[model samples]
Target: MATTFPQHPSTRLLRDLTHSLPMALLRTREAVVQRFRTVLSRHGLTEQQWRILRALDGRDGLEVSLLAEQCRILLPSMTGILKRMESRGLVRRDANQADGRSTLVRLTEASQTLLEQIKPEVVEVYKEIERILGKRKLEQLYALLEELEAGLLEGQS
Candidate 1:
């Protein structure tokens, strides 16, 4: 008689040996984004809009391509975001002086003021999450995520 083995690992073995890190990460990201979305909702801002605002907020003025790179968004999506932000008076876009073909993006005074007002609330959200996760775990999580991002981005490059 011949002995046969199962094609897949046993459920107990899978549960014990394999960590659902990816799924856990996805859920955590979704939860955090949802919380941030709630904050943005008060100001009628979408997630993409917030991302663009933060990118422009960090660097007063940037080219569309640079904004796209910072936000990790596609060019077309960034174009639409700019249009919406422009309409809402949150951002201004002009032809780059050095290169007319390139568009420059900047946060308008209104957008800057809005960002300043919301900065505390944003920080509060992060603080709350850190408190929940505890400082040590949060730091560890940040380190691990940074490593993962660096690896993935390096591979892309």
Candidate 2:
């Protein structure tokens, strides 16, 4: 026996209403992430590596634990990123000045130079995204996303 999908017009609309929002959001996120990854890759960076670099750029030195938190990455994964970055001379990891047990990661001069080179392109991409969405819609999107993120964090806790 063969199964039939719903043929009723109302059923189609209901299905779309129920599925389109999440599907569209996920597709949009995937597209944007792909673009971001492409940009980072050109600079010899992974998404996680970029996150670590960006964090350290804003604050030159940070504990690995704190960097992991800021990057929203697991400690093990962050350790891997740091190791690779360190090997490439993009970052330096040393015992925390005040705490021998904790490691502090800092960007190297090479990493800072790379960031300076890429900063303009990064800003241009951001501007393009905002232009595509329009300022008002972008603000609304940010608000909606912040609420969603907060709800997710609350649920996790």
Candidate 3:
């Protein structure tokens, strides 16, 4: 025979963990990112660094603050990441002409070449996702995610 503790009444009030929206989204993100992680790792880039590169791509440059916001990275962490990237010849920083107080960051020629080299693999990962999910479902997923984001943002505002 084994003794068992009684369940708390409050435990029944909470949603099941398996059905949690945030956890589901996080699980999905991790699953998807795992595929891209391999490609990023092969190119010696972290997810944050890849996000920074992608944000800067096709743009002349962006203010450090703007880049941090776009990349969803904190200002302090962005500073250190930029310093490492600059030292690695992946990025360059210059004084902002429009706003003398801010610094602007841009990808280096080497990073541009790296981006070109990595794009095919990145695209392939997207294609694989489309293949797995079916294009129609993938499009629906994108639309739903966009709608969800917009709705949440509107609620906040």
Candidate 4:
């Protein structure tokens, strides 16, 4: 027996999944993240945790809301991530002076030390990526991605 799928109505249009902008971006993101997923897992870190740590690595106190924005995580999700990191002694949150309602977060000494230890491995992953992608092509990819993001943002407004 043969199975067949229904066809799209003539008045409707649909984009192919392989050619979808959102799906392509998601696939590309997953592919790049897979390159470093093992290293993060070995260090007992999730991708979101690593992103938050990296964002706060060399910076001063960043407000929780701002940290969420920088990490590209939602505020509700950020709170849980912060809570877990706090339990692990990887991060600490302090009351914001100017805004009493807001709290600031920064990496703890334990995390700083862990980051120092993981720095080499992280750098190696990046070097390998550049090696495989070719430095020039990688730069161009970055530029194109930024342009695409900016264009999308502009379209929203």
Candidate 3 structure quality by residue, lDDT tens digits, 1-157: 9999999999999899988899999999999999999999999999999999999999999999999999999999999999999999999999999999999999999999999999999999999999999999999999999999999999998
Instruction: Give a tens-digit lDDT track for model 4, residues 1-157.
Output: 8999787696257678788888988998898899788899999999999999999999877999999999999999999999999999999999989999999998899999999998999899999989999999999999998998999999999
Candidate 2 lDDT score at position 85: 90
User: Model 4: how far is 27 from its true place, Å?
Assistant: 2.1
**How would you encode candidate 1's per-residue C-alpha lDDT over 43-104 as one tens digit per residue?**
88998898888988867589999889988899988888789889999999988999999989
**C-alpha positional error of residue 102 in candidate 4 after TM-score superposition, expressed in Å:** 0.9
| lDDT value, candidate 3, whole model | 0.96
Instruction: List per-candidate RMSD values in Å.
Output: 4.6, 3.6, 1.5, 2.1
Candidate 2: count the clashes: 0
Which residue pairs in candidate 1 collide?
none
TM-score computed on alpha carbons, candidate 2? 0.83
Supply every candidate's count of residue pairs whose N, Cα or C atoms clash at under 3 angstroms. 0, 0, 0, 0
- Using TM-score as the measure, name the better of candidate 3 and candidate 4: 3
Error of 1 at 126 (Å): 0.8
lDDT of 2 by residue, 83-133 (tens): 889999999998987999999999999999998988887888788889999
lDDT of each: 0.88, 0.88, 0.96, 0.92
Identify the leading candidate in terms of lDDT. Answer: 3
What are the clashing pairs of model 4? none
Model 3 clash pairs?
none
